[model samples]
Structure formats: structure tokens, C-alpha cells
Target: MASSNQQVPYGYEPPQSNVRGTLIYYDDFNDITDAALEQAAIVAEQMRFAKLVLYPLHEQTVRRISNEQVAPFYKREQRLQEWKLDSGRKSILVEGWDGKRKKYTPIEAAIRTCMDHYSSPYFLLMTPEMANRFASFATFEEWITKISLVLTRQPDHLHPRMETFRSRWRVAGEQRDKNGKQSEL
Candidate 1:
């Protein structure tokens, strides 16, 4: 939907035709359509029950999504480049490279050094009726012990269109997936 001529101070007022004879229902932050919002809502509900509703936001999340949700043997293959980090906290950085991939070039490991040490079990108290559970055991050995490897992989045989869904949605699309979908509601 194009912005209406009825411009307001902050931004353009949404055109009535785009809104379909309004009774203002709800709008997301950037003001995408209701159908988009509904699809998003459904995705969010699915994520709350699980995590599939949301797209991966971080580099590790990208790797995790690949391994658990899409690729079989994918470790977080993309590494982070060198930066002093926004916070002064010095983390044990681990560098790995993929000659074929582009993105975070060298991985900056979080403060938790899996190579040399493990985390102590830490807990979070979110609510009275419901709570969050996280396990922290020192060393990759313990962490790997508690985690189960997912059996899914990026099948080499999906239709070409299927390739888009496996990528990170946070950035501009350069892959087949980004140029593939129009995202209509």
C-alpha cells in the first residue's frame, strides 16, 4: 500500500484504500498490513510455544537454526570479525572461517569459553506461575552432554524455492530466498 497524500507531521498517513475502510484495529511498529500482522501473530504464538515463529537474530542463532531447524551437521559456521565489542567485557574469541560463505567472517566467542571452560548452572525467575529453565554446566563436555543433536539437514533436493527459507531474514536478501518470496498475506 502506498502512503496517502494526507501527510501528517511524523510520517505519511496510511491511505484509506490500503486500510480497507478502516476501523483502526491494530498496527505493528512499522505499520505493515493486518493480514501480515495476523500471519505474524500466528508465527509468534507458534514461537512462544516453541521458537519457530521468530526468525534468527544473532550469528549463533543463525547456526542453531541451521543445525536444529534446517541443516544436519551445521555448526555455527559463520564467524564474527574482530571488534573490541560494545561493552568492555573481554570475551575469549574463537575464530573460524568458511571459504564459501559470507557474513560474520570471524567468530567472537561470548564470555563463556566453550573451548577451555564451561558455565555453572544459572537460573532465571520470570514469573510466579511460570518460570524459565536454563542449564549451565562447566565445559563443552557437559553442555554437549545435555544437548541432543537434531537430525534435520538442508536437503540438497528441495525445490529451488525452498532455499530461501533457510537463510537469515535480518539482512537484505542476496540469495534465491530473498528475491524469491513477495510476502503477500
Candidate 2:
């Protein structure tokens, strides 16, 4: 039989996506593996070929655009508009990373910051290279990869510090996936 440890997941979809086309979400960077973008690309491709159903989250709701001086007692009703789906379509968030600067930002924010309306259909970047080229990583995989690389590069005398690098996620890909189902924190 093939060694069980030899197998690994080539790609994985993130756990959440309450938005379509523009939603880039993350549980922060979990040390840069670029898993987020990979998932988004796959979903976006599926959406392109099919008449994917639109969710309420994607619909336009009334907005008070400006409240600079107009609101004395008036407040916006930002309710729990939970994103619902009919089980056919899946959504993912995409983002960008700046390798040289060693930072990442939401693609929407980056576009708005440059005052450019141009943006990509995808939003959640999973790989560092992809994130840098794209716009942002909804989750930071770099930190994840960073910590991993650090542990791997540690000096011989620093084994204790290496234990901190050891994470329960280090199990073979399949087991790790199952274990990851629990709360991240």
C-alpha cells in the first residue's frame, strides 16, 4: 500500500463565504499558504459558466450615503442580514499582498485607495505570490508559512523554540483538515 503520509491536499476551500463577487473575508492571516485565492479561483470559474443564483447579500439595500451632519438621532440599521444560499453555489473571498512591503490589504480597499475603479472578479488570495499579484488575502497565509519556515530554519541549539513552531495542524493533510473543523482559537 502507498504510504499514508505521502498524500497531501493540493487545494482547499476556506470555511466561509457570505458574499459573492466582492466579498473578501478571512480569519486574519493564518500564516500564508495562499489557500484562500486558490479556493476563490475555483468557485469563480464555476460561477462563470452557470447562471448562479444571487444571494440577498449581493443585492442593493438603501444606504444613507452621507451622515456627516444630517444624523442627530438617525442611525443606520445594520442588522444581521445573514447570507443564505440554496446549496448550489459557493462563494470565496480574495485579496492582495505586497511582497516587498511584506503586507496585505483588501482588494476593495486597495482599489479605492488608488482611486481606481478597476478591480478583479476574484478577491481572496491564498498564495503569497498570487496575493501580491492580485489585491489582498482575506486570510494571511504568509504568517503561517513564515512561522513554518522559521522553525525549519532554526539553529541546532534552538530546539525548544521549535516546539512553539510545532502545531497540531502538522498532521498529514487529511487528518489536519478533519481536525481543523474545530474552532480555530
Candidate 1: regions farther than 4 A off: 1-79, 95-116, 122-185
- Identify the leading candidate in terms of TM-score: 2
- Compared with the true structure, all predictions reach lDDT values of 0.24, 0.27
Residue 65, model 1: Cα distance from true site in angstroms: 7.8
Candidate 2 lDDT tens digits, 38-125: 4433444533322111111111111111112211111111111111122224432122222122333343344343223223332322
Per-candidate TM-score against the hidden true structure: 0.16, 0.19
Candidate 1 clashing pairs, residues 3+ apart or interchain = 72-153, 79-106, 79-107, 80-106, 80-107, 118-138, 118-139, 164-177
Clashes of 2: 28
Per-residue lDDT over 3-106 for candidate 1, one digit per residue giving the tens place of the 0 to 100 score: 76754678666664211110111111122233443443333232221111111123433343232232211222221112113212232222222223333222
lDDT of 1: 0.24
